[model samples]
Target: MWISTSFFMMLHIPLRTETTSLMSSGKTLRKGVRKMKREILYPELTTLYGDGGNMLLLKQCCNDAVFRETGLEEVPWFVSEDVDFICIGSMSEPKQLLVREKLKPYKERIRELIEKGTVFLVTGNAMELFGQYIEDRKERMEMLGIFDYHAQRNLDKRLNYIVLAQYEKLPVVGVKSQFSQIHGLDNHHFLKMVKGLGDNEGSEFEGIHYRNFFGTYCLGPLLVYNPQFTKHLLELCGQKGEIVFEKELEEAYYERLRKYRHPDSPVVLGHGFI
Candidate 1:
């Protein structure tokens, strides 16, 4: 089932039998274990950094709730036939260029899938290329334009911890690190913001939201520290039923959050890439 508020969208997916059995078994299963719902990570041309942790957390969350998680790499690879969610992680400028080159050939298909209401959670620089254009130091490159907004490198870099106010009744918290500014769209409403948009871009323009796509600048493996937001994303991916918080998983999330609460927190930089 799908649930939506003015600023946020939620999807609830029913648990499958195989997934429940695996969780109940208490066995150490490999990464790619049960298969039911489809979840893809665009890893071919992107440097995910801590986004892998985000995906893992989501998988574990689903497992706790008795739902299956599958990852898709190449286009031709098997994708569980029914994709519930598609997540793209943060990428460096060079890696993004390479991924875009590979994706250029499949632009039409990608656009079609996005328009079909496929749940997409894009973070950091990965979202820049999904828009009209990205302005880098060297030159300006055309993007997928799936979103109406445009991204341009800002003269100053924005790096700080944020406390986003509740939007549509869901609490959101994430860090922001970007040298880019988004413009050209006014109709679309942002989820919410409680901190910096760099040079004070404006209130209603902190983030981007259109259809089932959600783009944000939150860096440090966002979903891991934000279970409420993660659960909301899963709901958008067709997750149906009660959102029962798993004790172990919830503890793990809070532990990580405590480590990364402050901007100067040691956990912030130790994770390699942000």
Candidate 2:
């Protein structure tokens, strides 16, 4: 049997892991676990920072797992379906407001999923959606109210960093670029800030970790570069064994880590959307 090399190249998947995304019903699945859905929220807007790569990476990790994308004009399938994992990536401040409006109708459902321990990996400013509100110089916008955190946006100044964090024995490295800083963020800090800024440049904490949810500023196709973290999520989704594509993913991770840690290597913002 043969497959198109271009298709694999399009997904940026490794040559050996090309078949992992061919799962029926648009999923990558594991054996014996109850079937579930994984959704990408508002791809049109929240698809920045190579966040779209996160979806492709998830497909690589579990070939039988089904994947869904919620567009800006459409309601998220998770609102109606049983979603096991949700990925919300970066977006602009205006787009973030639009998301809040759309999600407001399903607030209770989201809250219920969070309470029931649904796994969510929210990257970049997308994590801002779960906060109490967002305040800029112009106005204050109310958010999901899922957490005590509130965001303050500074249109005048943008913060960018080469940040690294080790969470649960895994090396998570990525770039952070944003105009808003979270404050009054009252939630569990998932990863320690080994270097660079946290909620803001003055702070040391980096992300939110509540139950099955992991929110972070690190945005290098978050999971693709964190195989251990992805394996943990696979376990949370009921895959009770070794993760697929482990060696390839780990190799890419280490290479990136070495580049980031080397003092002589130029540290600049790579490809990022929001």
> What are the TM-scores, per candidate, against the unseen true structure?
0.68, 0.83
TM-score of 2: 0.83
Q: Per-residue lDDT tens digits of candidate 2, residues 198-225?
A: 8865777888899998888787667766
Q: What residue runs in model 2 are displaced by over 4 Å at the alpha carbon?
A: 1-33, 240-245, 262-274
Best-fitting candidate, scored by TM-score: 2
Residue pairs with colliding backbones in model 1 are 11-235, 11-236, 12-239, 12-240, 13-239, 13-240, 154-179
Point out where model 1 deviates above 4 Å. 1-35, 44-49, 64-73, 76-82, 154-158, 161-163, 198-200, 240-274
Clashes of each: 7, 11
- How do the residues 1-274 of candidate 1 rate in per-residue lDDT, one tens digit apiece? 1111211211132222124434554755567754445444454433254555565555545542333332223552223244556667787666767767656766766677667776777877787777789875778888877777788775456444443434467655555656677776565554555443521365444556677777776655666556667777777865554333444335655555454455655322222233
lDDT of 1: 0.56
Candidate 1's TM-score? 0.68
